[model samples]
Target: MHIVFVFRYHIFFYTRCSIPFFTNDTFETQGRRHEVFVNKTIPMVVEGDDMSAYSQCEIYKTSLNTSYSALNMPPSNTSTEQCNKWVYDSSVLKDTFITQANLVCKRVIARANANMIYFSGKMTGALVLGLLSDRFGRKKVLIISTLMHVGGAFGSAFATDYIFFVAMRFIIGVSCTGMYSSSFVLGMELVIPSKRVAASYMLDMAWCVGLYILCFLAFVTRSWDMILLVMASLTVLLFVCLWIIPESPRWLKSKGRFIEANAVILKWETINGKKALTDTSSSKNTKDDIEPESVLKMCTIPNLLIRTLLIYLNWFVIIMVNFGISLNVGNMDGDLFVNFAIISSMEMLAYTFCFLLLNKTGRKRLLVGTLFFCGGACILSVFVMLFFDKSLYWITLVLSYIGKFGITASHSIIYVWSAELFPTKVRNSGIGTSSVVGFAGSMTSPYISDLGKYVHGSFGEVLPQVIFGACSVIAGMTSLLLPETNGKALPETVFDAVQFGKKKADDRNSRLNCFYTNDAFNKDELTGEV
Candidate 1:
């Protein structure tokens, strides 16, 4: 089959100054003040100036130039060619990525082994980067994480022995986790709240796109070592991208670089073609409104702790299942590259569907649905293996893929939920904690890979399958009683999420009844105010 090929990658970047601590909030006239994910519409005060304001103070500009295949970073054999030529020979580059299906799969296993450890770092990164961003600014942290990720990727690719590879992979895991958390936090925090959900979703989609590209590479490349090199080389371009992006302006003011913050906001607004809020004059005197509480204390707020813990558990499980199935596809006699690619395709669909339905379905329902789907699939997997020869292998393969789909959806959306749960003070803390847990899960994936080694043939794999199935069940059950966040705003205190969907239903109905009332018989009442 002819594959339509594409790839998505980000260049490395960093904050120029130290991230500042948030204190005065006078300049953020925007609604919704959750840290990590804040209101995107009314523009949060950055450097004490109107963030969305397009003009007035002008030291910079926020412009997004998406140059298509500009540098054409592909495999060594393929040279930069025309778009049509590239498309026709799409399989060429993709094959390079997959030449070592066994190798790639093994490396994926190796990567997952470090995943749990890596995820642990992610959780810790929120506080570290948050503090760093607030003290120095986002740009520098971004750069640091990006370069580190590149180093890790290349490091793992070139390591001479299994131990070195594992250690480097762990380092790669750290870089990835840190980069993922920092980039995501920065992206959402900088965007308008209205833009947040979509932007956040887009960020995940980029990873999916990256996977798609990886699959294509798998199809094209036959060499494992070169594939690693190609993957590592893909990120080197981030160095050039650093020239365009800037520091997190909010972090600047938090760090007392009031003028720099204001200047940054003014530049962003200019690129977006928006006028300053209430005149440019208010920009000069604005400051952050932050308390002195530590990130951990922020997490201890009421329901926040419970929600974060459960969510982390859920994250840990999902990552396990997601990578577990992918890494062990060989046990099922499935083509690792094609199966991995197909599974990723399904994940893309799952995420898209979830994003569309998330607000309408409520977090609890969506989350539960995912867990149930995954659990059900895993439970069915045992049957498929038991009946492997009777057309059941195909069914099992598809079933396992579905399990991946469900968990991927949950994994993708959980970050948004975390962002909403905590207040500005501990928003990063909560997310960081969850990230650490999630990364921990990823780290543990490698060890789980060993599960396949113990299992012999058809019957041998049953234990692994059964364990995976049961884990899903537990995760699903845990989700059943957890809080559901839907249309309602993210709660500031832990107590807010404790009530779950009940609160959202009541609040939603009240608001609708009052504002969107059926006017058939209440024409007079409706016009009373007028």
Candidate 2:
């Protein structure tokens, strides 16, 4: 399924940044590169007399000529937190983006910004690439996007500076949007509506698996460059596998390319050992009779617009809470790898919960319930941190995990809800718009988490929590306004979407009235005959 490929890219995007956490190396020589570590009694000379032997070089040339003694280095007095150079076991060797760019202490914001730029690119890409998929074709756009992903990953591995690394990450972000949006639309169009929830869960599982794999890879490699290179290499397999997949028949039909669509269907028929049932000419005539409307018309329909606004807010809240929790967890006081692994693993539970409950509870109930749960957990976490003793820190951790679980579930369920809400003519565009709005939340979340640390010590850490909890509550309540689409057929036009819920309500009332009237008539007839 195309979901699998897009899911791989999604996993890669989220997990790649965690590599720098383990791989950051403490500079053995903290200050200028030319500064040599030696015993205090021994004054090593490079090119000058004893008086000015170790004086700072005016030329600032290579430091290879200077004699240094790392073994007799000064005893460490400063804590690792305050020290410019950190002391680690000599056996642990790594090369990472943080170490290469020296992004520690004051420069740590650059690390977060790298993530920010990527989401920003995703926001832009969703709008641009979604339209491209509609105008050109899903297959063509997917290939182009996948190639870009491959190229960006390869380029990022060879980055010489933090700026270049961020730039490449942005490029990768854009490519991922293209691949994800195009492939998701293609896959959903091909599958029957009943199977969409299962398909979504499978893709979500694949994404979770990617994070688990990332954890193992980081443990073994312990080098950012190698990890990135390995991740990039795997995308090549996706590229190769894409060759055998057919263009989406729905997209082809929408574009009036019936011949190509028929051929693709025939290919599937041959594989399944079944005969073709429909003539291409007849299918073409049926499709041609219904003219496709402009995607922009989504804004003009009142009912569609109202529902779209709810979706937009829903997406924004989901992503804000999702990334807000994820980024904040890394900064929590704990083993970085352990924290990251725990957070990543929680997504599996969240998605699984949605899978089990989505059909039974329906989309509206699940989304609204999860959002309220997530918000309550977040607010509770803030109180625990403020009022509880230090020994009860575990309680705070527990609440954070619980909050993440609820938000993660909401994130997974929203995907299915948004897909079901839109009509066929504007589905991709509508989803793309919501995606851009959601990524905007992601783009801002890094800065919010970053600011939370400063607020934690000085301002009670309530600012970020207030924002997170409030957004969750508001978005959840707004969700009640949207229609439930459980077991309903996909709509074909804006008009169908507008009347979908009203029609359901009318049908239920009509059936109930008909039943009562028939019962009364039968009773009257029985009495007269007796």
Which numbered prediction scores highest in TM-score against the true structure? 2
Error of 1 at 200 (Å): 1.8
lDDT per residue as tens, model 2, 1-530: 11121111212111111111224433233444323331221222354112323211111112334432464323333111122332222223265666567565466567667666877778877888887777777788899989889988899878887778778888888888888877777777665556667878887888888777776666678676777878888888887768886787666665666788778877877887765454445332443224666567767867667888889999998998888887665446666557667887788999999989998899999999999999998888778867788689888787888889999999888888887787666667777788899998877765665565465462436667767888898999999999998866666556556666665434354322111111101112112210
**The CA-based lDDT of model 2 is what?**
0.67
lDDT (tens digit, per residue) of candidate 1 on 1-530? 00111221110111111112323322223234422211211111243112332111111111244122322212222222111101011222332222212123124344334344444445455446655644445577778878877887787567656566556555565556556666776675565444556777788788888887777665566444556677889888877877887765544433445567557667866887775341223243223222233445534445545656677788778777776666554334445567657877887888798778776776677877887788888778788767657555678778877888887887766777666555433455556666666656655655655665576565655776676677777887887766554433433222333333343334454322222121111223111211
* Per-residue lDDT of 299 in model 2: 74
Each prediction's whole-model lDDT (CA) = 0.54, 0.67
- Please identify model 2 stretches exceeding 4 Å from their true place: 1-93, 105-109, 273-292, 453-459, 504-530
**Displacement of the residue 418 alpha carbon in candidate 2, Å:** 0.9
Inter-residue clash pairs, candidate 2: none
Instruction: Give the residue spans of candidate 1 off by over 4 A.
Output: 1-135, 161-164, 249-261, 276-288, 299-302, 387-390, 445-460, 480-530
Scored against the true structure, residue 349 in model 2 reaches a CA lDDT of 92
